[model samples]
Each structure stands twice: as C-alpha cells, then as structure tokens.
Target: MTTDRAMRDTDRMERPAPPAPEPLPRPVLDSHVHLDIVGSDGAGASPEAQVEAARAVGVDRLVQVGIDVESSRWGITVAEKNPAVVATVALHPNDGPRLADLDAALAEISAMAEHERCRGIGETGLDFFRTTGPAELAAQERSFRAHIAIAKRVGKPLVIHDRDAHADVLRVLDDEGAPETVVLHCFSGDADFAAECVRRGYVLSFAGTVTFKNAVGLREAARLTPLTQLLVETDAPFLTPTPHRGAPNASYLIPLTMRALAEVKEVPLADLCDAISATGDRVFGPWP
Candidate 1:
C-alpha cells in the first residue's frame, strides 16, 4: 500500500509543499498566486492553512489572481473573507476563444472589478505561445484592451501576463493608454524588454523561475530592474523554486526566491525584502 504522500503524488499534484523556510526580515506580498487551484490540486493544504503558513514565514499578504470567470469569482470570495488576500479579476487570454459570449463574460469580469476586495485587473494581456491563427489571437487582443479599460476605469493596477508576445503587449498598452499603474506578472521578457518596461515605469513581478540555474536571461532582467520596480511571487502550485522545483509551492516558500533575487541584484537580503514590501503596498494599495 502506498503512503498518503505517495497516493497524492499519483493524482498529479506537484509534491507536498516543502517545510516552511525561515521568515523574511520584513513582510512582503506574494504579488500573484492561485490559492484555489492549490487547494483543488491536492496541494495538501486548505486556503486558510496556506495563508497561515505564508504568514508564519513573513509573507503577510497575497494577490489571488483569476484566469477565468469561475476562478475570478472564487478569488473575489477568498479575498472578502481573508484580510491577507486581495483579488485580481480577468479572463485569461487563452480562454478568450472558448467563451460563448465574450462580451457577457467581460461584463461579469467588469462587475467583479468593482468589489472592494478586488485590487487589480489581470493575469491578462497576451499569450502567443499557446494561441495560433488570427481569430483566436484577435479574441485575445480584444479581451486585453477591454481588461485595460476596466482597470483604468476602476483606477487600479493592470496586471499583465506577457508570454512570448512582448512587442504586441506593449503596442496594445500604448494604443490604449495603459492604466496609471501596471505590472508584468511573472515577467518573461529579455533585457531589452525589461528596459522598455522600466522606461514606461511598469512594475516587474518575478516568480520562482528566476531561481532556475538556466534562467540566465531572467536573472539578468532582475539585475537590470530597480528595487522599486520589482515584486515577487510564487505563482504557486506551478513555478516552485530551486531545491524544491518539483515540489508543490506556497507563499511560505517565498524566502527562497527572495534570497535568490537578492543575490542576483547584489543587495542585502533584508534591504531587498523591505523594498519589495514597500512596493507591494504601493502597487496593490493597503490590504484590507
């Protein structure tokens, strides 16, 4: 008979989250994560348990991001009940082509944006890697522009998910006039892309992928970014950091990424944590 951890492993969840790392010297937010997905994926922790675990490690806040209408609604509800969580609402670009009524779907997303617990609009923008053909790509562009409008109208930050489509993402933002605040969630751009984002003053949120030994470009991007323009996330249950890459990830594992980032930027660990903490408050506003 298999042990419980082994049994859960057979179900395809990433492995159980690693032991809690030492707490950070200063608190900072996991700028993006999918707590609902973590719970559903047999991550061996409830949402409340995840939050408590994160808090115990100095990750005092989180921004639960939604990729579709259902997940968006769940994020908002989670935020409402958890003081440590704030929600970001959006329809994932790849999900754009599947919607029977794109406009109606967007309308619901827009309405959700009005909730006080919802602090950002995104995990949106574009994904050229997964999308092919004009019709599907067109749907993503339309949804991206619409999400930008919602973010601007609500005066909240626009969280972008740019994957292999840096140029198009910037063009659309330029054409639509980006919201007052914008973030590139799990920023996957190169040094040149990082320069442009820096010039435009958008925050760059790095994930655990930065800790991968072969992620030279990502580490370089981190080095180029100023502390003020930087944020950290696990994008957990997904991009678990090195030494724990194959394991399930949670906010409690943030210190591992934080330390990696500090090394890349050549800054003291405590100082970098403080800067990221302050930037979190700046971009997402005070958590309620």
Candidate 2:
C-alpha cells in the first residue's frame, strides 16, 4: 500500500478543506494516529495545535503510532511531552524490505517498548497487498514475530495493522501465541472476519474509512463489534471520513467518524462515545 504521507500529499491538491463537526457529547480517545505526518499537510496545524484542537472537540487523548524506528523515537518524544498522548512503536510491514537490518530495527523498537509512554507494540502485521514478492513477505513476517515477542515480553498491548491479510495475520498470531492484549488497528474486515477477531478477543479500532460510502463491509464489521471491544481513531492525515474524504485528516476530525460509527451500530452518540472512551482505557491502560 502507498504510504499515508504520500496519500495525504496527493489528497491535499485534490480535495476541499473539511469543516469541523459538532463536538462529541463526551470525550473519546483516538486509538491510532500519525501526528507527525498529519503536521505536513500544508493546511494542517502544528502537533501542539492539533492536540489542542482535538481536546476542544472532546478528543482528549490520542495514541501516537510509529511506522519505523525514527518515527517510533519521535512518537515517544511526543508522548513524553504530551500528557494526553501515549505511544506505540514498530516497523511497518511495508517498510521491512527497505530496512538494512531488520533485527537491529526490531531491537530498537523493543527498547522503545519499555518506555513508560509506550503502552503498545504495533503498526506491525502482514500486508499481502503491498508485499507480493516472497523475500519481502518473509521479511515482513520476521519483523512481525519479533514485534509480537517484544510486546509479550514487555507485557504491553499488541497493535496490529491488518490490510488485505486478515487471515494470515490471525494465523501468525495464533501460531506465535498472541500477546494478552491485541488490537486490530484501523480494522478492515467484514462481519465474518469481525467474528473471528472477536472470537480471539481482539479489540477492533475503526477509522475514518468506515464512514466512506463504499465501506459497506466495514460498516458490518463495526456493527458486529461488541461495545467492550470497540475503539475509534482518525488514522490522521489519511482515510478522512465522508464529507471530508479527500481532505487532510487530524485528531480533531474524529467526532465525524465517531458519529458515523454510532449510526452504524445504532447506538446513541453519547453512549457510544462513553463506550469508546472506556474501551480505550481498557485496551491501552488508562491514559496518563
């Protein structure tokens, strides 16, 4: 898959700016976001401003997810300074082949996992879509296993990035004995797949993509996810929700996606917000 940053760059020229939605009835945390990349959208605010904007709209907390070693360290730094942010570290599956030493990269990620602000090990998992070559796929799998071990060893939640490889992701997790806490970040699956994830007790994190008009399958998955296993995120700088599909995304835009999710689950907006907030605390531990 194309990098989130690249997509955002293209989107900047093609789409109109998104108007902010009404603030949520209660606070909800964005379980996965790229605050670093989101800041690059020329029209976007600084990371500090982004955080403040999110807070003003009832998005009081966020999980800053890293896609590589440099970004992982940056995420930790951001988390250290922001009480509302927690970090998750890992090399993205799509980045495996580009790394000169996957083991060394994993080692750094492991060390980062021990940080107090780093509450999860993730953005790691299979991506059959982008990695079609056998060697690249092998490297991706190796990196994934290493991340799983690190998460289990450190006793932190394991955040997964399953993109067009849901079955393989589950197979690998089952083979390696998944960490106690597993989250399917930006969950991309159908109702049946959602059942599989639910059976394994993995949390399903919905992003702006779920609100797209063509995301019927995603909507089904959202509806199928239990209240306790549900989480919401912006996946900022990418996958901006409908009415803002082509615009640059940020944590502040989460209320639009959350409202869309509430509609899909047929739950009251305030109740869904409460559930998502509580689930965030449960999945990643209480926000510090």
Candidate 3:
C-alpha cells in the first residue's frame, strides 16, 4: 500500500483501540533562520526538509535572513520559491568591510526589498562583541548607518543585531531617526535595556539564550517586556534552545525557546504564542 494508505489504515486501527484525540499544534513563527546554510549540502533532506520538520513542530512561517550580498540574493531566491518563507537582506555587522561601497550595497539591498517575498531590512547593526579594532568598529557603524538609511528610505522595519554594543546601537539608531519599526533581534540585554527599547517602540526578539541556565538577565528581560512588544526567533543554524543546545539549530527549536518565555512571563503557552506571533506580524508586516 502507498504511504498515505498505510497511514490511513494505522489511524483506523488506532481510532478503534482508543479514541485518540488530535495532537495540539505547536504555536510558533520562527522569525529567523539560515536556510542557505542548512541547504548548502544539497543532498539529503535539504533546507526544505528542515522547513517540513519545523512545520511538524508547529512553526508555520520563517524569515530567511541574509548576511552578505550573495546570501541576500540567495535568501530572496529561496523566499520566491517557497511561500512559507520571507526574506530579509542586509550585511551583518561583522560583514562591514565586505561592503566597501555602501551606496552600491544599499542599492542591491533595496532592490531585494522590492521583491514580493522580501519582508524587511536587516539582521543588521553593531557587534562590539566581535570587533577587532577601532577601524573595524567604525566600519560596522558606517554599515549600520547605511542599513538604517535604507530602512528609512524603503519604509520597511529594521532588524537589528546588537551584541555587547547596546549603547552604541541605541545611539546610532536615535541619531538616524529610528526606523518605523526596529527589532532588537536575538536580544541579550538586561531588563533596563529591554525597557529602553520598549520605550522607544522597538520590538525585543528573544532567542535560545533565554533558555540557558545562566541567562538570568535575559529571562528577566523576557519577563519584564510587555507581551505586545516581545518577539521570538531561532537565529538558527546558530543558537539552538536548551535540551538541544550545541546542536545544529533550526526553526524547529523555537518551541523550546517559547516555552522558556512562557515560563518567564507566567503566561500560558497558547497566550504567549498568540502575543508573540501578533508582535512578529505587526513588526514584519503580515507574512507573505
């Protein structure tokens, strides 16, 4: 018998043995993932298979974010081919030097934003955590400013990737007249910073760090931030939530992070799901 036919037969037998109720769906929207990395092998299941795995765990949509010009183009191409995926194009803070001609890079990003499947501008911002020199920091700042300019010019939300440079990031964003909707993606700051972002009408996106045993500060921020201002992401093939920590990350791990957030906020999982999904929709524009 065909696979579908076998599943039907098994369902029929299981139904008679004991009235099996439907399984509760996993409520999640993995706001970020790196399908290009996951699909690089192009052999086995593929990144598309990863999407299927995520779907099995209740993730309905994912934003495929690009870290450089080539990755941005690949992200857009993937989104165009997959209805469940949306693309965000920008040079990551660490990739600042690669974009020597800021204007030309911005032009390319802007063009990608115009694509029907492209949803936002970023995964961009400052990363003091990784800068090697004053020159590197300056380059990162220049690239960040360029990204903000593009976000303003395109009138789309900005996805920020601040790491150990919260003050500088905030300062630059303020100086640039903050984009329409700013998201501190994978927020790892303290409650005060979260409050500051909330005060500025920026969204705070939580990642797997919230699930770490040593992440008291992140958990506090998760608890303190208003539900409407909170967002969630995988930042995967990177920050895998606990139980799966150090494993190859994917959108499928979002529930583990969400469960941690739900606990932090003292809210039911379903309610937390609704609030975060709504926040993501508001910030990114309705999923395509």
Candidate 4:
C-alpha cells in the first residue's frame, strides 16, 4: 500500500486544493494526524495555524502523531504550545529499516513518550507493504514489541500502524501483551478483521480514506464499529475525502469524512460527533 505522505506529495502536483466542508454540529477530535508533515505542504502553514483551521471547522481537538524521532519531539513541542493538541511519539514501522541505531531511536522515543503531553506510543506496528526482506520485517516486529512494552510501562494507549500485516500485528500484540488501551490507526481492514480487532477490545481510528468512493470495504468496517470503539482522523496532508480525492488534506476537512462516517454507520451526525469525542477522551485521556 502506498504511504499517505507519498500520496500527498504526488497529489500536490496533480489535484486542486479541496474546499472545506460544512462544520459539524458538535465538535470532534482527529484521533491521528501528522502536523509536521501537514505543515510542510509547501503552503507555509504553521502547526499552530493548522490547529486553528481545524478548530474553526469543529475539529477542536487533535492528536499529533509522530513517525520518527524528530517528528515525535516536534509533535511534543507543538502539543506543549497548543492546548487543542496532544501528541503520540514513536518509531513508525518503516523507520526501523532506515535508522542507523534502532535501539537508540527507540530509547529516545521511550523517554519522550513519558512526557505529560505525549498521550500514546505509536504509529508503530508491522508494515509488510514496504519491507523487502525478512531482516527488515524482523526489525519492524522487534521495534513493535518494544513499543508495546513502552506503552505498557508508561500506561498510555498503544497506537498501531498495521499495513498489509494485520495477522502479524495481532500476533505481535498477543505475544507482548497489549497495553490497556489500543488503537488501530487508519484502520484498513474488512468486516472480519474489524470484528477481530473489536473482539480484542481495540479502538479503530478511521481516516479520510473512508470517504472515498471505492472504499466499500472500509465503509463496511466503519458500519460495524460501535461508537464507543470508534475514532476519526485526517492523517493529513493525505487521504483527502471524496469530491476532493487526490488533493492535499488537513484537519479542517474532517467534517466531510465525519459526515461520510455518519452516513455509513447510519447514525445522526451530531451523535457520531459526541461519540467520537467521548472515545477520544477515553483512548487518549482528557486533554489539558
């Protein structure tokens, strides 16, 4: 599967910017985002500006997710200054193969994960989509288990990034014993997988991709997820929703995705908003 950042970069060259959708009746939280990447869209938007834009559109709260050491620390810094934002620090599944010292990077991530503003440890899990060898796969699994340990030790939610390696992800979690709270970021599974995750007491955080016309399977998964186990995110500047497909995305665009999710779940939009907000607080704890 193509990474969201790669899609965002190519989409930047090929599509027009998406117009913001109607604001939600009740505010909601974006459970996962990469403000560092969103801020680098060459549009010159700062992290603060992005947060402001999200708030303007009823995305009042957000989780700034980190995929590497620099982005993790940067996310913490952004969270420190922005009350609307909390952060998650971790080494992404893809990061293990690139880091010169994986252990050292994980150590820094471990230290940073303890920060008061850091509410989760992840974007870490298996990614079979990009790995080219067994060694790389082993490294990702090793890092994933270590991150599970960190999240457990810190008593924060474990946010997982499962990409084309769903079974392996579940295996690793079972092996290490999952943290009390677990979130499957950008949940990309069918109904069976969704049922499995839900059975394991994991929350599934849907992103803008759920709004895509071809995302029938994803929509099915969304329909099956209970409100208490549901969360929403942009994963910006990627996975821009329908009528704006292939365009750069941001938190301000989440109402479109939220509305799509509401339609899929056959729930009132306002109710979905309230549920997602409640789920956010439950998964990440109260934001300051």
Output the lDDT of residue 120, model 4: 96
Off by over 4 Å in 2: 1-8, 13-16, 40-43
Question: Candidate 1: where is the Cα deviation over 4 Å?
Answer: 1-14, 39-44
> Is candidate 3 or 4 superior in TM-score?
4
| Inter-residue clash pairs, candidate 3 | none
Q: Per-model C-alpha lDDT, please?
A: 0.86, 0.86, 0.76, 0.86
> For model 4, how many clashes?
0
Tens digits of per-residue lDDT for model 3, 1-288: 001111222222222111111222445688877776642221113667767767777787888887778889988888878777888998888777545686687678878876767788888898876578988888889889988988888788898988889999999998988988888889989989988999998988888888999999999888889998888887765666776565556676677888888889998888888888787777765766
What's the TM-score of every candidate structure?
0.94, 0.95, 0.87, 0.95
The TM-score of predicted model 3 comes to 0.87
Better of 1 and 2 by TM-score: 2
Clashes of each: 0, 0, 0, 0
Write the residue-wise lDDT of candidate 1 on 1-288 in tens digits: 001111234333634547778889988889998887664433345778888888988899999998889989999998889899999999988888878999999999999999999999998998887677999999999999999999999999999988889999999999999998999989888888999999999999999999999999999999999999999998876677898887777788899999999999999999998999999999996986
* lDDT of candidate 2 over 1-288, digit per residue (tens): 126443346645345556667999999998998888774442355678878888888999999999999999999999999899999999998888778988888889999999999999989998887676899989999989999999999999998988888889988998999999999989989999999999889999999989899899999999989999999988877778888777778888999999899999999999999998998998776776
The 10-residue segment of model 1 with minimum total lDDT is 1-10
Model 2 poorest 10 in a row by lDDT? 1-10
CA RMSD of each candidate after superposition? 4.5, 1.7, 9.7, 1.9
Backbone clashes counted, model 3: 0
